[model samples]
Target: MHHTIEVEDLYFTYPDGREALRGVNLTVPPGVKMTLVGPNGAGKSTLMLHLNGILRGEGRVRVAGMEMNEENLPRIRAAVGMVFQNPDDQLFSLTVFDDVAFGPLHMGLPEADVLLRVETALRAVGMSEYRNRVSHHLSMGEKKRIAIATVLSMHPEILVLDEPSAGLDPRARRMLINLLKGLDMTMLISSHDMPLVAELAEQTAIMDNGQVVACGPTAQLLADHALLERHGLAP
Candidate 1:
């Protein structure tokens, strides 16, 4: 079977000698949606970094059948689109349109194609009207949408998101959920939002101290309060 992402015996550590991941082995099939639910220090963000070769770790890590290395960095990055926790960090251009068009331009696409991709990506996230607006002037929700569009312009096959729902009100959260649901890419979302996981993911993995403690169907994991509590996902 073809897998979109593969992680085997992966290990990562910070510069300060803090171990982040310990022997993590994970495989994500093409087009599958998975959620990673873990505590603040469980290394969810660290693991996401490895998906696109941002932070290399020990052992094998692959995306879209390509191994993570300097040889495959460009291809791997084009295949894995990561939406960071903060939109401000992702969208840095002066105008929203420029921010969304940056990725395609960096990939060396033609002017016409780059503009077309920018327009399509913004429309996909329902933010086409704000294309000319300044990135710094947009609200949190709008910024988040533009961030997604920025990556979407690259036409990534795997979409990795970290805390996509953080700091959003109920309405904006729902809107973001709807936007995600409409996409057709393989999604790997790391969030603490139980309801969002239950609504979107078929599989869920709970991690602690950089290790996966439990992984199974989303419904099964959510149904077990004991397991949830063990992972600090429950009150």
Candidate 2:
């Protein structure tokens, strides 16, 4: 299998002396949909950052067959599109169209190609009509959709999202799930919502104290009440 993502004994420590990731190892093969669930401070964010070369650490981290290093960062980031936990961080342009077009534009796409990518991305996220809307004025769910569109325009091989449905209502959350399901790229999602995880991911991994304690089929992990409760994922 072509593993789009791979990490072997990955470890990270904050400047303040906190070890956020400890000997973490994970693999997301092509076309796999994996969800990561864990208690707060379990290094979920740290690990996700490493995937796109946003944060470098000890050991091996590879995205789209390229090692996570200064030299490979640019290509790795292009291959792995990351939608942050905070939509505000991802959506900075004044207009939704601008925000969605940001990546493609930076990649030096022509004006026509950039606009086409923006439109296609918005359509994929069900936000086509809101392209000209002011990004800051949009609702939380709308902002989330636009943030996703921003990454989708890059045509990444793998989509990585952190807390995707964090603040959405049930109806909006369901719609987001459907939107994500329609995408063909491999996905790496970190979320506290068990139901969303169960529905979106074919594989699930439980993290605790900076380590992935368990990983298996989503159905089996979701059904193990005792295991989840132990890891603070009880639903």
Q: Write the per-residue lDDT of candidate 1 for residues 16-36, one digit (tens) a residue.
A: 999999988887888889999
In every candidate, how many clashes are there? 0, 0
Model 2 lDDT at residue 235: 58
Question: Which pairs, if any, clash in model 1?
Answer: none
Could you tell me the lDDT of residue 75 within candidate 1? 91
> What is the C-alpha RMSD, rounded to one decimal, of candidate 1?
1.0
Candidate 1, overall lDDT? 0.91
Q: Rate the local accuracy (lDDT) of all candidates.
A: 0.91, 0.91
Model 2 gets an lDDT of 0.91
Q: Quantify how close model 2 is to the true structure by its C-alpha RMSD in Å.
A: 1.0
